[model samples]
Target chain A: MNKNSLKILEKNRDPFRSVKLTVGITISIIFIFPIIWMMFVSVKPDGFMTTNPVEWFTPPYTFSNYVDLIMNSLILRWLWNSLIVAVITTILTLVITSLAAFAISQMKFRFKNTIFIFFLLGLMIPGEATIIPLYEIVKSLNMIDSYAGLILPMIASPLGVIILKSFFDGVPREVIESAIMDGCSYLKLFYKIVLPLAKPAMAAIGIFTFIGSWNNFLWPYLSILSETLYTLPVGLPVFNSTYSQAYVQPMTANAIASIPVIVAFLIFEKQIVKGISFTGIKG
Target chain B: MNSKKKAWMQDLRALPFLLPFFIAYLIFTIFPIFKGLEMSLYEWNLVRKLEFVGLENYTEMFQDEFFWDSLWNTTLFVILTTPTMVALALVLALLANLNTKLQTFFRGSFFLPSILSVAVISFLAIFMLQPYNGLVNTVLQLVGINAEPFWMADKTLAWVTIVVVTLWWTVGFNMVLFLAGLQDIPESLYEASEIDGATRWEQFRYITLPQLIPIGRVILLLQILASYKVFAQILLITGGGPGGATRPLIQYIYEVGFTKNNLGYAATMSYALFFILLVLSIIQLRSQRSEGK
Candidate 1:
C-alpha cells in the first residue's frame, strides 16, 4: 500500500484515541445513569435511600421491593397482559400486512395502485388522531378492556405493509413465475416460497411491531378501565400514583417493567437497530 | 373467456390476500378518520350522539383558551425537542462511531434507555428530579450548587425535564439512524482527504457533514412529528401540572373525550392536530421529492 493508505489504515492507532475512548465511556455512563440509579435504588434497604445528597452505593440491599411487588401487586398480571397483547399484535400485524403486501407487490389487479395508496394514506394519519373514534367503535363493539381492542387497532398501521411490500417486490419474478408453472397456488407460493424468502424483512417488521406494542401507553391507558386488563406501561403509572409515598417499591416496579425489555434489547441489539433505522428511513 | 373476464379474475385472485388487512385498516383506520370528522360536527358523548351541533364544536375549540394553550405547548415542545434531539443524536452517533474496542458498550448504553417504556422513563425522571432528596438535586448540592430546583412545578423547569427525559429516552434511536448514515460514508473519501493532509475537523466539516445532510433532515422531521405527539411522558411525569403548562394537545383531547365525556369537542381538537400534522407531512414529502431530483 502507498504511504497515504498506510496512514489511513493506522488511523485507529491515532494519538487522540484514548481521549476519544474516555469521552465515549463517560458519555455512555451519563446516558445510562438514570436506569442504573433506578436499579440500585430499587434494591436499597429502606431508610438507606432517604439520606440527603443521595448515595450511589448503599449496602444492606434487599429484594423486599421486588418481593412486595410480586406478592402484593398485580404486576405479574400486567406483565402477562403486556406480553399477550404485544405478541398478538406483532403476529397479527405481520400476517395481515405481509399478506396484503404480497398481493400488492406480486399480484396484478385492478385498483392495485389505489389499494396500495389507501393503505399508505394511513402513514399520514397518526394513531393519536384516530383514538377518539376508535374508542367509540371499540365501545360499540363491546371490545373495550379486551385483547382484541388493544391488538386490532395496532395492526392497522401501514408501516409493515410499506416496508414489506418493497421487500416482496425485490423477490425475483422468474422464481415466482416458475413456481406458478409448477402448479403452485398463490397461497402455497406465498407460504412455501415468498414468506421464507422475506424472513429478514419480516424479522425487522416483527421487532418494530413488538417494541411499539410493548411500549404503547396511550391507547391502553384510555381504553382499559379494569385494573386486570392493564398493560405494564398503563399499570405502572397507576401503581406509582397509588404508592407515591414510597420510592423503593415504585422503583422496583420500574425495574421489573424495564429488565425484561433491556435483556431482550441486549440480545437483539443488532436486529433492533437495523429494524429501527429501516423503518425510520423508509416510513 | 374474454380478456375483460380474465382481468377481473386476476383482481379476484388477489382479494383473499388483501381482505384481512384492508378489513382491519378500514374498521380501525379509515373508518375512524371519517367517524372522527363526523363526531367533530356534532354534540357527541362517550355513550351516544347527544345532538347534531353543526360546527359548534369546532367553533368552541377555536375560542377555548385551553385548546390554544395545549396546541401552543405541543408546538413549543416540538420546537424544544427536535433541534436539540437532532444535534445531540448526531454527536452521540459520532461518539459511538469512534473506532474503539468499547464501541458496542457505547452503543448499548446510549440506546438502552430507548427500550424502556415511557412510564419507566417518566417515573425515573420524577424519581431523580425530586426537589429535596432526588438524585439530581442531591448531586447538584454535592457539587456545591445549593438550589433545590423543583423540576416539575416550575413552567420552564417542567419543559426542561420533559425535553431532557424525552431526549434521553429517544435520542438513541436517532443516533442509530445517524450511525447508519455515518457508516455508509465511503472509506475512500476519508482516505483521500487524509492523503490531502486534511485535519479531522476539516474532513468532518466538508465530507461528513455534507454526506449526513439527508439523514439529518429525515431525523429532524421525524423528531418534530414525534415531539408533536408527546403526551404520555408529560402526562405521567408532571401530569401536565403546575397549572397545565406542559399539557400537549393530545392530553387535552384525552381529557375532553374521556374525562368530560365531550367526544365532539375532543374529536374537533384531534382534527386540528391532524391538520397540522398533515401539513407537516406534506412538507416532508415535498422536500424528499425535491431532494430525490
Candidate 2:
C-alpha cells in the first residue's frame, strides 16, 4: 500500500470506531431483546413458561397462546375501545390544538402572549397529578364508564399547540395578509389557507396524540368501571389478574395490544422523528 | 373609526379559535390543580360529609411516616432514573453517530421498545425476571449460576427492576434527542479539533458535551418529571410488593383517593407532589430563560 493510503487506512482503523460499532450493536440488541422475547413467549405454549425452563430455542413453537387469548378474553373488545377513544381524542385534539395554535401564532389579539403563557403552565402539570380531582370531576358529571370520560379530559392537550404554533409561526405574514386582502373570512383562512400547509405538522401531532391516548393507563383505569369500556392498557392488567395461571397466554394479548403503536411508530418514524426533534428544538 | 371596528372584530375572531381548548383546559386541568390545592386543606373523604379542617390534612401529612417513606422512595426513583437514562442515551447517540451502514438499523432497534406501552414492557419484564423458570433465571442457571433472586418481589430489586425496565422503555426517546443534538453540532468543529491532534475524548468533552447542555437540560427536566409519573408499570410489576417498597406517591395517592375513598387526604398528598413538581417547574423555566429564549 502507498504511504498516503496506509495513513488513511490506519486512521480509519482507530479502535474507537470499532468499539463504537460493537457497543452500538450490543446495546441495540439489549434494547430490542425485550420486545423480541415478548414475541417469542407470546407464541410459546401456555404453561411452558414455568414448566419448560430449558430448550429456549429448540423444538416446540405453538400458536395456542395467541388462539386461547383471542377466544377466551376481551382483548379485541379492549382494542376497539382504545381505538374509539384514541380516534375521537385525536380528532378533537387536532381541532382544538390547531385552532388555538392558529390564533396564538397568526392572529393579533390583546392578552395573546399572556393567554398563551397560561396554557404553557399545563406543560408542567402532568395528567397523573390531577387524576384525583379529574376523577371526581368526571364522576360528578356522570361520565364514568362512558367514552366522554375517556376522551374529554384528553382534548385539552398543550404540546400540539406549542409544536403547531411554531410551524404556523413560520408561515409568512404576506401570505395571510394577501388572503385577507382577497376578502377571505377568518375561518376560511384557517381551514383552506393554513391547514393544508401545516398537514405534515398535523400528522405529527395526530400520531403523537393517538399513541399517547392508546398507551394511557392511568386515566382509563380510573374512569372506566365497566369491563366493556376498558382500554388495552387498563384491560391487560385485569386480564392478568383474571387469568393469573396462564402467564404466556396473557403475553400473547400483551403482544397484540402493543402491535398497533409499534407499527404506527415504524410507519411514521420519519414524521415522528421530525416531531420529536421539533419538540426538542421548540423547547 | 373603521380601523377601530376591524380591530374589535379581529379580537373576537381569535377568542372563538382559542376558547374550545381554553374552556376544556380550564375545567379539566387548570381548575383541578387549584381544586387539588383547596382539597388538601379539608377533611372531605369521599363517603363522609365535607367538613372544613383547615390545614389539618397538610399538618397530618408532615407527621405521616408513610408519606415520608413514599416521598423518599420517589426521590430515590427520580435520582436513579434521570441520570442513568440520560447518560446511556448520550452513549447510544455517540455510537449511532458513527455513520455506519447499521446506523439507521441500530437507531430504530434501540427505539423499538420505547413505543410499546409501559404495561407491555412491564409484562415482558415479568416473563424475563419471574424468579422461577423465567428466561433470565433459566439463562443464568445454564451458565452455572444458581442465583434466581426475586426481581420484583424483593424490595431493593423491585426498585432496581423498575428503574431498569424504565430505562429499557424510555432511553430511546432521550437517545433520539441526543442524536438530534449531536447532529446539530457542526462537523467543522470536529474536523478542526482533529487537525489540532485532539483525541476523541477531548473533542467530545469540549465540543459535544458543551453543545449538548441545552438539550441535556431539557432531557434532564423531562426525565425527572416523567420518572415521577411512573405508576402503572410498577403497579402491575411489583404491586408495591415486599411491604410497599416500590409504591410511588402517585400510586399511593391513587389508592387513598379511590380504593380507600379518602379523596381529601389523597388530594393532600397530591398537593405535596404538586409543590415538589412546582419547584422543578420553576427550575426548568429558569433554565429556559437563562438560555435567552
Candidate 3:
C-alpha cells in the first residue's frame, strides 16, 4: 500500500514481464520459421528456392507449381486414398473402442481384468516392431495393395480402447444402472446414456485417431506397392522422385497435403489439445 | 437359475462388440508375433524352401556389424532426441501458456509442422540441410561459420542431423500436450506461492514442476519408445545413410525383410527392438509410480 512498497512491486514485476515477453517471442519465431519458410518456398520460382542469402520476401511468386501439381501428379488420387482410409479407420476405431470400453467398464463379466490386460499388452508393442510380420500376414491374405489392408490393421489400436475404457469408467455408474432398471435393453442403454455422457472423451479419441491414421506412412508404404493405392504421404515422395527436376510440383503437393490437417486443427483445436493432454496423462 | 442364465446371455451379447478386435488381433498381432518368432528360427526366402537353423539368426545378429551399428545408432538417437524434444516441448508449452500477444499464432505455428505428413517435413528438411546450396549452410556462411558439415554425408554427423530433424518434427506435438497439462494446473497455486514471497524460480520448482512431473514422465516414455522406432525420416532423408550411419533398428528390419528376403532374421531383430522397448517402458512406469508414492 505504501509508495515504496508499490515501487518495489513494480520493479520486481518488470523483470518477470520482460523475461516472459522475450521467451515468448523467441519460441514463437523458432516455431513459425519452418512453416513460413515452406510457404515462401512453395511460391518462389523454381530456381530461387536454394538461392544464397535467402531472399525470402521478394516477389516473382508463381502459381506455376500449383498448376503443374494439379495438371500432372496423382496428387488428387493420393488425397482421395488418404481421406477414405482415414475416415473409415476413424469410424471403425470409434465403434470398436467405444463398445469394448462399454463392456469393460459397465457390463458384468468374468475374466474382465484378464481381457483388459490382453489389450493392455498392445500398449507395449510398437506397430513398427510388428510391421515385418504383419507384412507377411497381409501378403498371405492377399490383401496387399488394398484399402482394407491399411485400415484393418490400424483399427485394433490398443491405445484407443484403453483411453475409451478409462473415460467410460469415470461415468456415474448409477445412470447405466437406472437405465437398465427401467427395462431398457443393454443396447438401448449404451445408445442413450453411455454414448452421450462419453462425448468429450469420444471427441478426444476421434480427433487423435483421425490425425494418427492420416499421418501413418510406414505400414501403407510397405503394404501398398501399387501406385494407385498410395496415400498422400507415400505418393508425394514417389512424385518427387519421378519429377526430381521439378521442385515446384513436389513442393505444391506437400502444401496441398498439409491443407486438410491444418483445416481440421483450426476447427477442432480445443478437442485436439484435450486429446493430446489425455495421452500425456495416461501415457 | 434364471439369474445365472441371464448373466450368461449378457456375456453372449457382449461377444459381438469384442469379436472384431479379437479376430483382427489374432490375425494381425498375436498370430504374427508368434509367426515372427517362428520365422526367426529358420532361414526362409520368399519363394524357397525353409531351413530350420535354431537360434542361428539371433547369434548372427549379435556378430553382424550392421546389426550392431544400427542398434547403436538407434540407442544414440533415442538418447539424444528424447530429452531435448521433451524439454523443448515443456519450454514451448510454458511459453504458449503465458498471456501474451500472438498466443494463438505461436500455438498454431508450432503445431503446423506436426499436422503435415512426415513426407513433406522430411523432404523439406533434406533440402534445407543440403551442404552446398542448402538454406542452413547458406545461413551458416552468413554467420561466418565456414566449413559446413554435410549433414547426411558424414557418418557421425548424419545420425546427429537425422536426430535433430526428428526433434524438430515431433517437439510440437509434445509441446501441445504439455500446454494442455499446464492449463490444468490451478492458477491459485502460483498465486499462493507468490503471496508467500516465492520467486518465479521457486514457484516453478515447487508448484509447477511437481504438477508437471506425471505428464512429463508420460511424454518422456512415449518419446523414448517412439523415437527408438524411428524409421520413415531415416528412410526418406538418409535412406539409412551414406554408409549405414543413420540406419535405425526398424529400417534394418525392413531391409532384412524386403531387400534381402530374409523374413526370419528381420523378425528376430524386430523382437529384439520390442524387448528393449518393453523393458524401458516398464522401468519408466515403475520409477514414476514410485516417485508418486
Candidate 4:
C-alpha cells in the first residue's frame, strides 16, 4: 500500500512485461503464419517452391497465378453465387425472424408459447442430419441446382428468431403501450420502433447468418448438380480435386476465396466478435 | 366462451408476422425430421422410393461394418478435439486478455482463420503439409527432422493433420467466448484475493477457473456437437483415405446416399448420428437443470 512498495511492484512487472510481450508476439505469428504463407506462395513462381529451406518472401514473384485464376477458373462465378446467396439469406432471415420475434415478444397471441417452442425445437435438429429429407423435398419441388434451393432453405434457422426475440423482450412495456395509444399499427411499430431499438442484435445476427450461409457447404454441395451453381465452399473443393496437381493455382484460389471474408472481418471486426460471443452465451 | 373468442381474434394479428418463418421452418426443418425417419424405413434412392422395408435399414445399419467404423471415427474426432479445444482456447483467451499494447492484434490473428471458409483452411492444410515442398515439412527438415512425414497419407499423421488443422481453424471462436466470460468476471474478486496475499496461481485456480465454468460448459457441449458434425475439413484434407482411416459418418452417409444411390440406408445412418447428439443434449440439459436446483 505504501509508495515504495508500489514502485517495487512496478519494477518487478518490468521483466514479466517483456516476457509477456515476447510470448504474445510469438503466438500471434504462429496464428497468423498460415494465411500469410498462403498469400506468399500464391504469388511465388511454381518452381520457386523447390528451394530447400523455403523462404517466406523471395521474389521472382509474378501475378500469373492470380491472372490464371481469374481468366481460366470459375472462381469469380462461385464468388458471385456465394455473395448473392449469403446476402439474400441474411436479409430474409433477419426480416422474417424479427417479425416473428416482434409478435412473440410484444403481441398478445394465442399459441404464442407453442409457436415459440416449435421454433426452438429447431435448435436441436442439426441441418446435417436432415439433409437427406431436405434434398428429397427440394428435388420434389424441382428446385435443385437453382438459387431458390440455395437461398430459401437457408433462411429459416431458428437461432435468429431466438436471438431477436430476447432483444425485443427488452423493449419497455410502456414503449409499446404508448405506441399503441398513438394508434400505431403493430406492423409500423415493429418496423419503426422495435427494429431500430434492436439494431445491435440485428447486426450480430446478420453477421452470423451471412457467415453461415457463406460457409455452408453440405446443402449446396448436395443440391447443386450444375457446375455453375456452386457456392465458394462447394466449388473450391471440386476445383481443388480437379486441379490438385497444380500448386500455385489452387493456393491462389484459396487466397482469393478468403479475401472477401478477411476484408469483411477487418471492417466489421467488433460486430463479428460480438456476434460469436452472443451466439455462444445466448445459446 | 365470448372472452375466449375475443382473445383468439386478438391473437390473429400475429399470424401475418409468424406465418413466413413458420412455413419455411415447417417445410425445411420440422418436416425433414419426420421425413428422414420415414425415408429410413423404406428402400429409397436419390430419385425415388424403391420399397417399404420397415426397420430393415436400421437393422442393416446395426450390422454394417463401415457404419461402425465411421461412427467410431467420428467419436474419435470428438474425443481428440474437444478437450484440446477448451484448453487451447482458454490459454489463447488469457494471452489475448493480457494488458498488452498488441491485445487487439492477438485477438484478430487468432480469430482470423475461423472466419475463413472450410475450403480455404483445408486447402491450406494440404498445401502446408505437402511432403516434399510444403511449409510444415520444409520447416521440420530445417530443424533436422529428416523423416518428412506424408501428412495425408499415413494414418496417424492423417489424423494428426485433421485434428491440428481443425484446432487451428476453430479454437479462436471458443477463445473469444472465453474472453467474453473473462471480461464479465468482476475485477473486485481478483482485487480482494490479492489483498489476501494469494499467489497468482492460487488466484487463477480458485477465482478464474471457477468463474469460467458456465461458459466453459457451453463451449464443451458446443465443441462436442461441432466435432461430431466434422465433415468438410476431413473430407478435403484427407478425403477419408489411407484406406478410409479418417472417414467420418457423415461422409459415409454421403457416399451411401449420393455416390452409391442408397438413400434409405443413408437416412438410417443419419438417425444414428441424430440419436447420439440428442442424448448428449439431454444429458447436458439434465445436468444444467440439476445444477440450477
TM-score of each predicted structure versus truth: 0.96, 0.94, 0.93, 0.95
**Each model's lDDT:** 0.87, 0.82, 0.79, 0.86
Q: After superposition, how far is residue B93 of candidate 3 from its true place, in Å?
A: 1.5
Who wins the DockQ comparison? 1
Better of 2 and 4 by lDDT: 4
DockQ of predicted candidate 4: 0.65
Give the TM-score of candidate 4 (chain A): 0.91
The alpha-carbon RMSD over the true interface for every model, in angstroms, is 1.7, 2.5, 2.3, 1.9
RMSD to truth, every model: 1.9, 3.0, 3.2, 2.5
* lDDT by residue for model 2 (A229-266), tens: 88888888777776665667767888899877778777
Question: Residue by residue across A88-129, what tens digits does model 4's lDDT show?
Answer: 999999988988888888888777898898888887887888
Q: Candidate 3: where are CA atoms >4 Å away?
A: A1-14, A46-50, A54-56, A281-283, B1-4, B285-293
Cα error, candidate 4, residue A119 (Å): 1.6
Worst 10 residues of 2 chain A by lDDT: A49-58
Off by over 4 Å in 1: A2-15, A46-48, A52-56, A281-283, B291-293
What is the per-residue lDDT of model 2 for residues B1-293, given as tens digits with 9 covering 90 to 100? 69889888889988999999999999898988887877776776765439788888888888988888888878888999988999899888887777678987787887787777767788778767877677887777878888878887678888888899988887878888888899899867876776788876788799999999998998898788777777888888888776988788888888888887788999988878887877787787788779874
Error of 4 at B101 (Å): 0.8
lDDT of 1 by residue, A7-101 (tens): 55657536676787888888899999888888898898753455464455656689887887899999999999999999999999999999999
In the range B147-205, model 1's lDDT, one tens digit per residue, is 87999889999999999898889899999999999988988898788778887778889
